[model samples]
Target: MSPNPPSSRALPPLVRIEGVTRRFGDTVALDGVDLDVRAGEFFALLGPSGCGKTTLLRVLAGFETPDSGTVSLDGRDLRGVPAHRRPVNLMFQSYALFPHMSVEKNVAYGLARERLPRAEIRERVAAVLATVGLTAQARRRPHQLSGGQRQRVALARAIVKRPRLLLLDEPLSALDKNVRAEMQLELKRLQLEAGITFLVVTHDQEEAMSLADRIAVLDRGRILQVDTPVELYRHPQGRFVAGFVGSNNIFSGHLLPSGGLDVPGVGVLPAPVGVGSAAGLVAVAVRPESIQVAAADAKGGEGLLHGTVLDVSFHGGSSRIAVTVPALESPVLVTASGPATVTAGTPVALSWDPSSAVLVETEETTWKTGGQAT
Candidate 1:
């Protein structure tokens, strides 16, 4: 028998923010931001500091109210819904577990507020604690557990209440790298098992990329782009999206009439697509891996630009080379699969496929002083 296909229904969004704006005195923290969290999907809000990521999270948790918008949960307008009354739970950056309360008490606190039968509360708390792998340490207090353990306890407590929507505010920021990786997996598993909508706010791009089904890249109170991690990486809409999501080497040149761009020393690069400009300033964005470096004067290759190796850094499994092309004002970055074959002050040539480079429109009138194109 064929396996049953997943059901399709116009399931209402678990969380929705419409025309949300938050201001602290004269400083606008969020500006007409709109977002949606589909049921049972892991969605992430990603941005740098002062970009309004956290402020948006606060609005969804009912910790803060929008000056001129509505926050809704499952199609119900949530205006004036106090934090405690809303069917949403927030996992804070600090984890915020009570120091005096044991793991069991911490998880049972919310259930007790609801006054469930004692047996049912105990059973539910036990199940949640086990789900987070903290059942063995039920009697332990916050001080006795490690950072990861404390975080899991916080997760257990938030989940025990079984809220329809779960909000996580940088939930794994404090753990060590290895522990954070493990928790990322665990959190995904728990979210799958629980089948509730999860909306996370984080500045760590890697975390957001790994954990989210889709990401909304925010900046200065505005969402610049929203798409899957792969889509954002492979086909960024603009220079900002390309540079922000990952490392990119950018070069500035003018589009030529022959469907190619002329770099002073790099020669004409045929445009991958019809650019339709003869002398307009343009920026070319390419990832380090896209640029291939070889010994200077390597014969029989198209799109070659010769340069001197200004610096090289070995970063385990791959090496980064900073090459300075004479015509370009700054050095271009290229990543080799293994250790560098050419040392500093040595000559090298860089070549890349026409398809690998993305032409961008420059926003800044003058390039920055350093070699950094971003």
Candidate 2:
């Protein structure tokens, strides 16, 4: 088996979820879920909507009781603890700032509810406001501040309690594209400075990849894969993860005995040499950026798949080229960093190193030794 990318941090898990199950009537929102979040490392539970990420988050928050299994924080069991009693804070996507109150007041409300001293509350609020870069706008109401600033207010309010774990539910969904991108960086920085374990639930792959040190991909009601961002993109273990995490050109074929994938019409695609007797049907996933494409003069043959360039889209730093191969059902997507030389409707040749292609199986099958999976 190939080695996976090392996690950035290897501290002990601050939050441990074991055999957790939640159901609403006949619908099972979470099914025997297990996960561990390292101390002070930013983590994300990522999946599509209704994938049970929210239910897991609610379970941790004590809002939804699990049907079975146990949840522990800092080695302490949280079976019957109430939401407010737990050492965790949840920041909603809505920001949910009090419209009538100023930014400082909104943040200070949580502390005031706990009946903290006046001097201590003033000092902590000032410090957290400064940390989130909202000191100048402390007195300004949420209605008076920008979207990003209001988000900071909500975050500051959550972290003000110095909670051991901070849960963020679709934290950036409210912001526009540009502002959301900016806040991603801000959120990462805040997590580091606050020195708290931040576990965010987001359906956005980009957000999870960019913000979290490690991410758990949830599907249906089960955890599909938990890995670092780079590892998840570079080495997806199964067909579902390959299709879900990023754009992949997947080719379904049978594993050849001679260490190659046998597509019915495409001949044998190269797999790693010395692959043992593992055979049968499998899917090969090649990332768009991994494949190389160039214009073909006459009909480039020999270890190359000839195709017609269908589309070339320039996206700032790179251009995405789509080529339709005669034997393939889907276009072979390729990414080029330089200028877009090949125009649409031009003849092209698609080729990539054997190492660039990954042999992927369904979620239920064992990993086969071939292609990149080797």
Candidate 3:
């Protein structure tokens, strides 16, 4: 799903989470977290497993109660709100559907429970099934449908109620790669068509980056960063975010007077002037795509670092080259465009623009309400 940027922090909030902390025995699932999701936006909680993303979603869904803090939805406090009463719906990764029920029945189950009129239930179910492209399979049982179809059925059921907020937990993780790709687009289309606020929880970075306009990155029960996909990619705040979001070549050492990293053995790496402290321990992170690599003998003033190409992988439009520099503990990865030009075992020189080198904190930082990085 492509990102649709929210209006601003000033926009009316649909979900307000403040200092919500939940504990299961001695384990702290959520660590004094504060988040605000704007109305009509597709937001994502992105993190690795056991990072409290799911726990936060459950709190908002009213399935789990927080030990401390409060959760408000559309200016209404949800302290005593039951899961069924709240204007919220959760779509699980398993896509739980009644095995004996037909597609239309599954979609109509919620409305039926509310004892709505038969005609109204039918009309709403049919409209939702059509929205998810499942009108043709409305009569099929759960087992008769494909994995993607069952997923669509679950989604249709959730949105048929026209809930104010729809929560999806690893929505497309079960499907095959091809089907997952198709469903991503389908899910976004459904969100726009239904005009429902979506809060998706996924550990897949690419999934969050592709689907959410704003992503809240969580780790160890804390939100490390929240920003647009491009901002998080190009301007990650610290080492954890830089390493987690994508491949980054990091050079760690003392900071020089001219804003360059003074490595003990790898030599100085470039950085923009006035980046950080004049002299102190620091690290410079450079993306693989930003690094320029060429045959060692291929001129251009002795490049920044010299290494031997350890491996080269062709990825259709791009090539991944791993170069082993003797001074660094890990190999430096370079994402060169097009097919491979340099082969393994060949000595190569790597150089990147000074401005591309970002000085990232060695420790994780917290993301607050003022749009500060972590």
Q: Local distance difference test, per candidate?
A: 0.81, 0.84, 0.86
Write down the RMSD of all candidates, one decimal each. 3.9, 3.9, 4.5
Best of the two (2, 3) by lDDT: 3
Compose the digit string of candidate 3's lDDT tens values, residues 1-374: 35455454568989999999999999999999999998888899999999999999999999999999999999999999999999999999899899999999999999999999999999999899889998999999999989999999999999999999999999999999999988988888888789899999999888888788789999989999988888898888877888888788777776677666677766777888877863445667889999899888533347988888999999999999998886577888999999978999988898888899888764233221110111
What's the residue-level lDDT of 317 in candidate 2?
91
For model 2, residues 214-286, the per-residue Cα lDDT tens digits are 8899998999899989889888877778878878878766767656677777777766554334455677888
Q: Who wins the lDDT comparison?
A: 3
Provide the clashing-pair count of each candidate structure.
Answer: 0, 0, 0
Candidate 3 wrongly placed segments (more than 4 Å): 1-10, 297-301, 362-374
Off by over 4 Å in 1: 1-12, 263-270, 275-279, 297-303, 360-374
TM-score of each: 0.89, 0.93, 0.94
What lDDT, from 0 to 1, does candidate 3 have?
Answer: 0.86
A best-first ranking of the candidates according to their lDDT comes to 3, 2, 1
Best-performing candidate as measured by TM-score: 3
Clashing pairs in 3: none
Task: Please provide, for model 1 over 54-119, each residue's C-alpha lDDT reduced to its tens digit, 9 standing for 90 to 100.
Answer: 999888888888899898888999998899999999998999888999999999999999999999
Candidate 1 vs candidate 3: which has greater TM-score? 3
